[model samples]
Target: MNKRGQFYLVATVIIVSIIAGLAVISNYSYEKTPSKFYPIEQELRIESAKVMDYGIANGKNTNDLMKNFSRDYSINSDSDSSYFVFGKEDNLTLAGYNELNSTTIQINVGLGEQAMNFTKGQFQAFNFSNTGENIKVIISNVSYDFKLNKGQNFYFVVSKNIDGEKYVATNL
Candidate 1:
């Protein structure tokens, strides 16, 4: 090979080696487990209401369960002491396909105090996938109970409305 050709071949080989090394490192460090928080029983109990819904709706309820959730969970701007849950569920079934859509569940809990505001604010990122649709629900800030020296527990719920039929509540 000519001088220029030899230099070009060497450069190409070096570039390929660097790229291959980076690819191997990236694949090795890839995360297999998802990131999440599984609260202790103490903390989980405080948010039992929300937790119950998740268990029941997914047919995980071995115990007798009777809980009602509104389609939308909302709170008043002035006072967060009280909140409202409202929404509609729609179902679509044809042939062997089935889907449910829940629309508009709002949550406004607590007084929106500094701590509550921060805690509840994280609810914006809470979401679920249902029947090929993405449903968003806001958990109220008031749903949390805090204790000194102990980690706080917060509860929240969301639902979506499909075209017409009622969708079952699944997760909180």
Candidate 2:
């Protein structure tokens, strides 16, 4: 039989169940890791250009900017990114690779016979002269080619890993 207060009791139970489900969901989310890195890579690309410009205007070189940005990002973001920033006109090359960690990823930056590899959180510049040639990059076994424009043209390759998935972005 339907009682006057019975409906109110059923409604209250339904509301409480919904709220409890939401609470469980919220708690579960905080324990899981993401499976993608493109989102982080995109945000870095947008903000990094501004910072790079500021650094260049202040007479800072690409190598310096790359090191500083990598350091700053490691300090500010939960995710880690490996980066290679270089100008085509700059006759400098420094390349090193370290094992990946929670704060490190891998990227190979190359021009002709000159190749530089970087691990996240490690900043070392290698200097080599370019004889009017172009450079290409390989990420996750995929090769990409791009033209290098004239005069102080700086490029960046940022790579990150999440849940065994790797994502990379470039400002070319």
Candidate 3:
């Protein structure tokens, strides 16, 4: 083959390789997954359940358990901000705030018939008690409902914003 023909063929191959590399890099730049924090969330659920079991065996109150679990989980996970909603008996506690990916994503928190809506990055920790009724929580168009009993029952929710969408991991 002539030198000129060989040079042109090599240049075309190089150009194609560059374009393919750029395409692959762009796709890998941002990835969105519904279960962004699945592993961490599963760990949260298991640990919380164990805490509850220990508290029950020792006849400890939910308030103490909630406080310790919240603090320890926040530190150990080293994750973004997250709010917690959990309690037993007539008490339901909602604490901490979860960071949002965008300012337009809707956030809602509910307990029983009362529901509070907050804008993105506008969430605040709040607490209230129930009157032997069902507890309801609505977050980013998703709804979670639970019925509390006399036993050491608790519910924990963790949400992470992934590409402007809310992905939640919960122990229900």
Q: What is the C-alpha RMSD of each candidate to the true structure, in Å?
A: 17.9, 6.8, 5.9
Question: Using Cα atoms with residue i matched to residue i, what is each candidate's TM-score against the true structure?
Answer: 0.21, 0.51, 0.58
* Candidate 3: residue 152 Cα off by (Å): 1.7
TM-score-better candidate, 2 vs 3: 3
Model 3 Cα lDDT, one tens digit per residue, 1-172: 6999999999999999999999998888656576548887777778878888888789888567876787567545535555566776456666554443332222233322455443344344455654455666665556676666675555666766666765666776
Candidate 2 lDDT over residue span 1-172, tens digit each: 5785898899999999999999998888454445454576577666666766787789877556655665566445544444443555445333333235323222233434333455445545555564344555554456555455664444555555666765555666
Candidate 1, position 17, lDDT: 100
Model 3, position 131, has a per-residue lDDT of 42
Highest-scoring model, TM-score: 3
The lDDT values for all models are 0.29, 0.54, 0.62
How far in Å is the alpha carbon of 109 misplaced in model 1?
40
Q: Which ten residues in a row have the lowest lDDT in candidate 1?
A: 92-101
> What is the Å distance of residue 52 in model 2 from its true position?
3.3
TM-score of 2: 0.51
Better of 1 and 3 by lDDT: 3
Clashes of 2: 7
Clashing pairs in 2: 92-127, 92-128, 93-126, 93-127, 93-128, 94-125, 94-126
Cα lDDT tens digits, model 1, 1-172, are 5999999999999999999999998888553321122222233334445545565568663122211221112221111221212111122111000112122233222223221122332112221111122222243222322211111122322222334432222223
Better of 1 and 3 by TM-score: 3
Off by over 4 Å in 3: 1-36, 75-81, 100-112, 115-125
